[model samples]
Target: MDSVPLFALNDCDVMTTNGSKLGTLENITLNPNTGELKFLCVNPSSEESTEFPQMENGQVVVPVDSVETTREYLIVTAP
Candidate 1:
């Protein structure tokens, strides 16, 4: 983490390539001063893995540079 101000997006919609609602951005991890994003986690309504058992439905890391652009929200390419 570079200690940059974390990108704060509220109720920002997130979707997979296939257009699946992957929840919203829990929060963005970035290198503060450097302004480099590191990883992001999903803020699922439920943290219970067994409740929503899906390998894909979970916190996944997004590459720093993969972010195309961030406006009201961020558009990150799925890895």
Candidate 2:
């Protein structure tokens, strides 16, 4: 794992493992008590994936555990 700053993820595109574009990184979710990552809030850029639940603020919530990589895009699991 590399030491990429969390701020680098801002506005980064998020994609599924199978190559489906979900959206852009809007925010991150974490466990306040432990400061552990929980999920990623993605602003809708495409309606190609619906495996994850969405938020009321129009951002799709993606589990951080499902993320495979974080480079130019946040690669996440399809389901």
Candidate 3:
């Protein structure tokens, strides 16, 4: 896997690589042993969110590998 530059995820917006707004990040799931980030739980902004994977609880779930973070957004790679 390629390295993702670390930054604060707090209150970050989620966007697609093509620049579509998904929503704000709600939470993150990680492995305690290896400190590996697994998934990102996000709040869907609108119907535009239907394009990505989501949890049964109605939250958008973005894989960490699909993320590219900036100071403003967690840029999600298109599948």
- Candidate 2 TM-score to native: 0.85
User: Which of the numbered candidates is closest to the native, going by highest TM-score?
Assistant: 2
Per-residue lDDT of candidate 2, residues 1-79 (tens digit): 2455787887889887778788888888789999888888999886654888987777899888787666688887857
Per-residue CA lDDT of model 1 for 1-79, tens digit only, reads: 1223343455665544444455666666768899656666656534544222233646655555555434544555555
Q: How close is candidate 1 to the true structure, as a TM-score?
A: 0.50
- Residue 63, model 1, lDDT: 54
Give the RMSD in angstroms, all C-alphas superposed, for model 1.
6.6
lDDT at residue 11 of model 3 (Cα atoms):
62
As for model 2, its CA RMSD to the true structure in angstroms is 1.9
For lDDT, the strongest prediction is 2
lDDT at position 24, candidate 1 = 69
lDDT of 3 by residue, 1-79 (tens): 2454444666678988788888888888889999988988989888555666888878998888888767567788867
The count of backbone overlaps in candidate 3 is 0
